[model samples]
Target: MPSNVPTFTDLLAGAKRSAVHLEMRDTYYSNPRFESWRQGHCVDWNDRASWWRPFHQEIADAVARGVTVRRARVVSEPVTEYIRWEHYVTHANVTAGEQVRWLPRRLASDLLLPGNDFWVFDDTSVEIHHFSGDGDSIEDEILSDPKLIELCASGFERIWERAIPHEQYEIH
Candidate 1:
């Protein structure tokens, strides 16, 4: 990303309508949060202030403004350890005012999904994240192309429609 490129926080903070994220990876080790998850077994879901902090605070602020923040994940059955870890920590996401859902890969087979993970903000701008085979984020790029934005928005909705809400999905 260039110096002028806006951060994900900046994108969310600027959203005037809905902000949606689609995650396709089953394992992510690049986040240091995973380290804590690995050692502690779970995120401190009850410690609202200490646990979520500014990141969740940012999403809360957006929700306060009526920006419907949602995240949809597509994972395989017999979920990976990292995914189980994510399933456990996601309660914080719901508590912070974002809606989250999970789509089993088997259930999403026919959907024409994007090849990358992305965040589409306000149905306008899109940020695509590229990760290496090991699941480390190698690069991310922001796109203003109307076609790409529409594609991402539609793809997210397709997955969202098929996914089970966080409260309903059981980790495999």
Candidate 2:
């Protein structure tokens, strides 16, 4: 028998309007869902070295549209590699008008705290009960919280500040 699994769309039907806050460990961005979201211009986070390709493409897209994309890392190596490989070597076809930013890992954590209003911890083991009082139902709580929207916007700003300018990185 096929088990009834709830998909994001199902959850979204009942979810509130607040912007989502997704938290994942290093490298979750490699998931196909992340790639789809990137292609659609949605924001995401991951701290792994292997995500350079998708990350580069996402950033390049954001830049070309004259949108600012920000990121943060707890460590420097991944960022450095991203700079060298994606920015320097491939010289991915990014537009001159786009802007990118990065932030230290500590700051990334600060923006993800409890008081931020609505948050979405995207992973396999999260249960609806765990988020009961901590925030709102992915289906219902966010629809009413304006604060959550602001918090997400603020988080994006921090990432923007720390990111390196594309041209400065030596695109190969």
Candidate 3:
């Protein structure tokens, strides 16, 4: 990404209307949180203090300011263990006021998707995330080109429309 581009934190902090994220990978083994979960560290749902992370706090703060936040995940059916854990702990996202949904990959077969995962802020900018085959983050690029932004924003909506809300989606 160019040095002039604002970080996702900055962009989200400044978002006035909406912010949306789309995650399509089923496994992100390199994520420390995922690794911890894989090693038996689980969120104590009864204890908010134990699992309230900064990322969740960011979303919460944004929501408090009236910035609508949404997230959609496109996953393969018979989900990977990482996705199962993510589903188990998604309540934090809900508590943070993000509207999250899940779309089975099979259902998204006909939809055109971006080459990378992304976050669209206020429909004006996109932060595209690149990852390796094993799901390790490689880099992020922020783009404000109208065409790219439109593609991501529209694609997110289509997936969101077909997705099952977090509360309604069951792990297969």
Write the number of the candidate with greater lDDT, choosing between 1 and 3: 3
* Candidate that beats the other on lDDT, 2 or 3, i.e. the better one: 3
What lDDT does each candidate get?
0.90, 0.35, 0.92
List the candidates ranked by lDDT, beginning with the highest. 3, 1, 2
What is the C-alpha lDDT profile of model 2 across 124-169, one tens digit per residue?
1111212234233334232224454445445544554554454453
Segments of candidate 1 deviating more than 4 angstroms: 30-32, 40-42
Give the per-residue lDDT of model 3 (tens digit) for 1-172.
5777798889999999999999999987467777788899877888988889899999999999999999999999899998998898889999999999999999999999987899999988999999899988989888899999999999999999999999899999
| Local lDDT at 95 for model 2 | 32
Score candidate 3 by TM-score against the native: 0.94
Q: Write the per-residue lDDT of candidate 1 for residues 6-116, one digit (tens) a residue.
A: 999999999999999999998875567777777875555566666776888899999999999999999999999889888988877888899999999999989999999
All models, RMSD in angstroms: 1.4, 11.9, 1.4
Residue pairs with clashing backbones, model 3 = none
State, as a TM-score between 0 and 1, how close model 2 is to the true structure: 0.33
Steric collisions counted per model: 0, 16, 0
